[model samples]
Target chain A: MIGWTRRNAGDQSNSEAVIQLTNVDYTYQAGSPFAATALHDINIRIRKGTLVGIAGGTGSGKSTLLQLLNGLLLPTGGAVKVLDHTLLPNMQKPRLNALRRRIGLSFQFPEQHLFEDTVEKDLMFGPMNFGSSRKEAQSKAVEALKSMGLDEALLKRHPLTLSGGQMRKVAIASVLAAGPEIVMLDEPTATLDSAARRELIALLARLCREEGRTILMVTHRIEELMEVADEWIVMHEGRAVFQGDADELADRSEELDHWGVAVPEQLRCWAEWTARLPQLAALPLPRTAEDMARRIEEAVHGFEKCESTNIASKEGSQQESAQELNDQADSSMDAPYRHEKEVSACVTS
Target chain B: MRDKLIIGRMIPTGSRVHGLDPRSKITAMLLFTAALILSNGWPQLAALTILSILVLTATKIPAKTYLRALRPLRWLMLFVFLFQLIAGAGNGTVNLAAADPLLWSGTWGPFTLTSAVLSSALLAVSRMALLIVFTAMLTFTTTPSMLSRGVEGMLKPLSRKGTGAERFSLMMRLALRFIPALLEEAQTILKAQAARGADYEEMKLKEKARLLLSLLVPVTVGAFRRAEELTTSLEARGYRIGAPRTAYRQLIWRSADTWFTLLFALLPVGALLMRLTV
Candidate 1:
């Protein structure tokens, strides 16, 4: 069924767990009256060589969770372990610096970390800071630029001179130059156009597949991550409300919406179509467009016998009244009350 | 909105000025300032003023754009001019007796409204204007990272004395990068508060201070949180501060830099010679 179990089971062993957050709880400082809990009882284990998607609405503590993953932030109540180094609350400064080198993090915006004169120097900044030789760093910078689909000629141009999408790629490549095993990006495609967003996703997916790097990406667009994600973790109001495979997400689609997440349109359409067909109601939920199409075809065939019998019965009765009832049912599907009833019936029965 | 913030940002136009190393530009600007300060006669000031205007014209940035850079400092410039004109200890003499009678009537203790004081104020304003324009030209041509690295390179010789020059340069770069982000965040927070009927701007002075005080808690907290996340992301990418590493864009000196250095050095030398000869 291409569910969570199947995906996780298919992944190779010995990939190593790169990040382990065990029962992590985080709270903001208490001086302010508005100080609130940011994260609660979060336990997540990310394996190496997988692209993990973290999906959550605004103020769901997604940013807080990402910081904890790389030891940038300490858990107020629990432990966070990244690449053999563990960080508890109030760790000493020297230990934190030691943990930073193995993790490459790209902040949300392209401009925040870009301060170099030329694209080349900015890309080399991280590698150089980590004690890489000048020649090796320059080579790594060129490779990073190529990986981001930027031209070698751009090496001498100022980063601010690049177009919006190009600047974003440069910013990302700067991190990639450092070659961190675990790469975490926060809303990397937030402001990019569709083509740029697609290119970024493809590049990140390839990075995980070709290089076997562990990628943890936090995105608001759940549908965009559908094809690439190995695991989908959904957060709601400071808690990990759901964590499992992509297909498992379909089962919790209703819960996701109630928690203020915009459910993927494909899943919503599948749920609607399933509600109108009595025979299709028994089939398992589908997560993607292909799965939904296949399920719909299977249901159509299962209803073929009953549809033929119903057609024969309608032919014998008042055809006008039968046709009128069918039209009314189709139109009623568009109504909010009817839609809720159908979804509730699908859920309960 | 984003474009407004990016308007005056340093664009790499590949102009001769942009190609020069930032350290050379910094040194030249320092010398240029010294020449302005050392000038005691009108001829020396005129030479310094003409030199600054020539450099400003060479930048190729539009006149309107350069003027816009002065908008932020306009009030401060006005304040300096007014303060010097009104408060200067001047000789008690009616130097402008042939001028308007209304100007002669206004007297503040021993200070009289005279052409000498007015000319001095004008000279000061002109000098300040030239300084700002020159400094803006430097920033407009060079990117922040190059400027920081240039500063770091300049301080390399002092590193043997156990100074954290590289660290300071890094902090400067980080600060420049964070300013816009922090401003945007503050705007968002302010909007959110206003949406909740906080009306911070409409409040009384004491109330506004209280509101501003309340914001510091969240803003500082948010800043620290962002710093934490940024640091983690940076560390995950194998960034190590204070580690020895090679540079991708190596700073090189060119003929243009040498010319600019010579011009900067000549200005002060000319001013000093004029002072001695006079």
Candidate 2:
């Protein structure tokens, strides 16, 4: 609810705003009989160098939001501001090649768009379009390939001949070859396996952390992004229902189910521990299972120590201390709820 | 460009035209095309145009969709009009003396721009537009599967022994089915390329051609991949070609279909009467 009522995201200072949308509305084939409104009154501000996850279900307008950000589709009603350029309704759309070169958008199943005979030429396509010299683009292509954890020798092979995971990585490398300042992907790890998805996300996190490139990734499975995302935007029925840091998302985790987003097990476990020990609420929400387990153990032990000290001062008896120990065991048994078991299993795995 | 393509797009409005049998609709389309081609003079063409607009309106689809179908062929229609004007080959059909007065017949100019030739050129373009609109109406009112069934039913007599009709019908069905999907895939690829800095809309004509050539490879490859997958799925379901599969949707030809087709049957007769009298 904190981000829901913050309709005035445009009031923020411009220094940190890399992308901003104020009262934006987009309709597919607007003014036609088959026209559909994909987004409505969307107001958001994405700061520079942050990895944001856009979570939504099918037909929730996640893809439309990415297209609007990259100038692939102009907002039919309101303004779309990306980088230094501003787009308004009915204005002459100026050439966006310069703007597009800095804001790379990789569509869902981007590998299907790869057409070049060789992987190296496919990777170089973006940089060459942005007016880079052939030699510069070639080196950039190699850099992108290496960054994607791909072999340099694979560059000479046809893109279609590669494995599905490798083709997806090569496709992503093609988008990164231009060295964009902002990268937006629509379900980049959609069909990838768990290990491949982890590797791709880790690579994207490194891109944001090391190269200072802002990344916006669209995904329905928020669990995969819980550990990496700095911020979250939950969309429902074309409206951004929630937009905030992980703590706010945790606070409103119950509302996520209503928005068609599943609450990750880690968040549920964190909630259980915070409810049991109110003292844990003072700390930041844990993003990983190991962090959650450590915080829960430390808080539970500290609470037990305080209880034992109180019991010793009030009634100095062996029987009451034994009772206190039994009570502690009972609480610990109760603390490992289903969510905790799942999170602990995640940790062990 | 994706939005402009109205072919293979069916808008269901539950109108009378939408309820008629696809066989009747297809028959009407054939009859309508015959009438359109047979009509030569201004009065007959005007009648056919009015009839086409009436039939199109009966489908309850927006006129803008029909017009959008013609948008892709505007240049080709213009070429047809110019070719007709320059050729001016209507001398055998219409008596020039009875036609409109000649504007120029000077000795220095072997070619002449007369009112008759101009009207004939305009008529030719109108015919082309009507043909496109009528075909669009067929697709707009009927889904691809229904149209395929209708085709199979119509060609059943031709293939009394073999599976030729069913095979041809299935091929037509698949081609019809893939038109919209292929267009959608093409649009996705186009957007993906645009995102990677090859903005098709901003490119010059030559660059646009080159970009389209690049897209052709991916689109064809994607089509082949899709076809292979579809083949696997069909085979997994034990779908053998011409395996005497029973119809899931039996097309019932009601009296409404008869009435609907009769309306179109009148057009060719009216055109023939006009031709004889003229």
Candidate 3:
């Protein structure tokens, strides 16, 4: 328990690299007839305590990259450094189970791996394996499940009997019970509905913001992750083509469509918003719907303030102009992606 | 490791054997099995070996594949050979012309050893090897779905005895379909556990046992879940037990089928004659 807790204390160092990869090359089934190089000369640097979203299309080597993060697959060339452990290609890997215990990887469709009948045993499994006492493991399991927003009463029930979403959460909770500092998830919200996806994202954000666990979530649903991810890493054909903060991402997001990732809808809406109304263009880019609404609220407030000043100057001719201005603002803000007339009119309105 | 196995694998080649009706292939396999069981001595064994080699060569698949099928069972074959050699040595006969000549007399801790048993052991090992190779040939030639359909057609007559033969074939088809799916799933589970600090390659026996328990339960659950979904889909498609149905891809029998099956048809009769007279 002490090692598990203290092991991640290094991950809390904000500026240092939690994961550093240098010229890594991975070929699946190397030396076999089917040997195909999945990754070649991949170099990446993930800073400590950042919730980073990894975006890519299918067969872009996103899952293969996650496997390399925790030494599940050794590099065929170059080096990988995570925390204090450094993995060199073709070198006899020094005991890596210690490194694994500190980095909890929640794979895609993880619930399908839950073999234990009872949820309690499944959650406690990781902790127990890493040498926690039964009592200590039980507490850790409870703590992990609670953090995942699961009811503690469900711990004694069979994991198989749980709903698909619940089983997925419990499967992740089982990994978290080991209490690794760096958590990497591969498309964690892949199969969930929109609302469930939001909840899962919020939970992951909480793990980063409050719990101080660095997360690298690989996903195809880039728009969903756009709101919460502190930064993004875009991969294309087994290469990290882009890595930057959300503002830089929004700036370069138009080109993401060429790489097979749709420009997140919010970014599209923001582009339309800024291109028409040049006044608020300098403001920080908003990713979520709420963020967009807040930005629009500012625009509306600015218009109202300007309208009030105009109304004071032209007192007798004010009422009719105010009504028209309100109509113009509503039409422009509502259909943000619509024609240029409403977008340009709203700024003057 | 499982991927290296060549058993129950179909190699696609439009050869004389591969293009035959699956029922003809199935019949040939049955006849071959009977011949293997009834053949008693050297001449019949030689006929079976020649027949196996000819049928295998007709498939155009590499001979190495048939050998690869036997690779996994090599250890078991050796153990069986040793057991046979030990058990037959109690006859109290010795043939020690050459050095050793598979002969060693006197009690060595457990039992007595003599000479003549080595001949019998070689025969038994050869018979076992032939049986495995012949079965491997049948699997290599026929695709699983076609094989299942052939078995269903062959077993159709048993439905008259109320033994539910088509159900057995259906069960077999389902099993054949799911084996690869299950293997893939089990691999994923193994990786998931490894990511959670269950070091399978380095764990002690007790820890390995625990890892197996973790693997087995999820796989069982996944199977049931898959079965439930399959049942629903089948029912939705109007599948019914013991209902009238027509073949979508009807089996076409040709002269080449009869020509191939005729060779196998002679062996079983020849074997029965040998069994009775020899």
Reported per model, the fraction of native interface contacts reproduced equals: 0.00, 0.85, 0.77
Q: Which candidate would rank higher by TM-score, 1 or 2? A: 2
Candidate 1 clash pair list: A100-B235, A103-B235, A103-B236, A103-B237, A104-B236, A104-B237, A105-B233, A134-B246
Query: Candidate 2 regions off by >4 Å?
Result: A1-15, A306-349, B90-111
Q: How do the residues A1-73 of candidate 3 rate in per-residue lDDT, one tens digit apiece?
A: 0001222324434578899999998888675333678887888898877889999888888898999988878
Clash count of each predicted structure: 8, 0, 1
lDDT of 1 by residue, A299-325 (tens): 443354344555554433434433343
Q: Largest lDDT belongs to which candidate?
A: 2
Residue A178 CA displacement from its true place in model 1, Å: 0.9
Candidate 1 regions off by >4 Å? A1-15, A30-34, A277-288, A305-349, B1-278
Q: Which candidate leads in DockQ?
A: 2
lDDT of each: 0.70, 0.83, 0.79
lDDT, residue A314, model 3? 52
Instruction: Give the DockQ (2 decimals) of all models.
Output: 0.01, 0.79, 0.47
**lDDT by residue (tens digit), candidate 3, B39-146:** 755678898999788888988877877887898899999998898767664332221223235554555677654554665566667888998988888888898989
Q: What pairs collide in candidate 2?
A: none
Residue A127 shift from truth in candidate 2, angstroms: 0.9
For each candidate in turn, the TM-score is 0.49, 0.89, 0.79
lDDT of 1 by residue, B20-132 (tens): 89989988989999888777556777888778777766776666666766777788899978876885424323122233233333466886656556766666777788788
> Which residue segments of model 3 deviate by more than 4 Å?
A1-14, A20-43, A58-60, A71-95, A160-164, A233-263, A271-285, A293-341, A344-349, B4-6, B13-16, B40-64, B89-116, B157-165, B242-248, B270-278
